[model samples]
Target: MAVPHLVQAVAETRGLGTDAARYWLELLALTAPDDRLIRELNGWTGKDIDAAATELQQRGLVIEARRRGATRTRFLPGGWMEVSGPDRPMDVWKAPHHLLWEDDRVHGMIPGCPQVVPPAELYLDVWERIRGGDEPGYTELRTTPHRRKRR
Candidate 1:
């Protein structure tokens, strides 16, 4: 279970329900994979930020890395992924369009958002990348253990 920075933050600062926190974690992972997660820090005050982050690490929802004089961290979603649908690595579906539709699952606000990774690509891409997040986004894996495309 990897701990995304935002998930760790919400859990610590807002006491975000685990389910909601998980939802948002997946959301951000797909929507803003490269974006730094300090928004979680910004949403807090005083030492609550550090407190929440520490608790998140304790819960195994996040991990921290230290190098030189700098430190970094992020979230992990394997627990949720293991129990999710289709019994495979699922991709993040992005749709920032009121034209698309929103629910507990997928939605978005970026129309003609070709600038985005084409959310449709995530689910198609995840099965390969989920095992080892060694690549940039979830779609860069070409050596999937279960190499079967959906029909």
Candidate 2:
């Protein structure tokens, strides 16, 4: 299944949530780092944050926002920052592996995937339907009602 619009975009930043998606886009579009303080987006991290950042920088979707610590300066992909500030958004798309890294589930299963596959060996889907809080009636995929008992 196709990844949801937000999910695909979120993978550009961090997790598969709208906030995560917007964070990276905001950082890319922001002229100054201070702009992020309001939402406290300046301080955020996760196990995958570094990996995501590295991938984005390599793809040119992001640049070093700073020069200290893990923060370096970011610039458009393939553009020499020494000569010009940055390149247009279009240029980054031409770079190698320009697209964001999407997990197989997102690329293969559902958009903005939540990784709820559990164990593939067991009947996980059946359990999901039973646990989704929706009362499961004795019915088939069409959800046909069970036979009624005579009064």
Candidate 3:
């Protein structure tokens, strides 16, 4: 079955809304290279994206990676900082939410990051862009390729 159909089927079997299931699938897609369908599905405003990301965070499925220059900080649920400090100048809480996932790793809160590209593909895009003397800055791509706990 196609991805959408498969997701819908499994969701129905589990008594879950297909839309929610599809949305999470779309979120997972955001971590890899982009496709036309993924782009169309992700056309929501930043606010909508943030709301969905918040939902994922609440589910404990992903964590946020806040970056500034050469420094990066990861935040877990409940606004807990991976590194402790009251004087950390970055107001990550107020930043826009974006997620990047590749393989088993999920990264969140990358500002200005676009939706989905596989880590290897994204790295290649970045490399090619740099080779052409262009800043990669989340260049879009096409075609490609999550966690949880039991109850």
Local distance difference test, per candidate?
A: 0.37, 0.34, 0.37
Candidate 1 regions with alpha-carbon error over 4 angstroms: 1-42, 67-71, 74-151
- Candidate 1 has what TM-score? 0.28
Global CA lDDT computed for model 1: 0.37
Candidate 3 Cα outliers beyond 4 Å, as residue runs: 9-20, 30-40, 67-151
Candidates 2 and 3 compared: the better one by TM-score is 3
lDDT of 1 by residue, 74-109 (tens): 334221121122122212232231122333332333
Q: Could you tell me the C-alpha RMSD of candidate 3 in Å?
A: 17.0
- Backbone atom clashes (below 3 Å) for every candidate: 13, 6, 7
- Per-residue CA lDDT of model 3 for 1-151, tens digit only, reads 1155555653564344554444444433232212233335646554544564455456553345654321422222222212122222222221122242221222343533443455334333433433465421233567554346778
> Using TM-score as the measure, what is the rank order of every candidate, best first?
3, 1, 2
- Over the stretch 24-120, how does candidate 2's per-residue lDDT look in tens digits? 4433332222322313543454433455456655644555443322123443333321111121122221122222233211131222212333322
Q: Is candidate 2 or candidate 3 better by lDDT?
A: 3
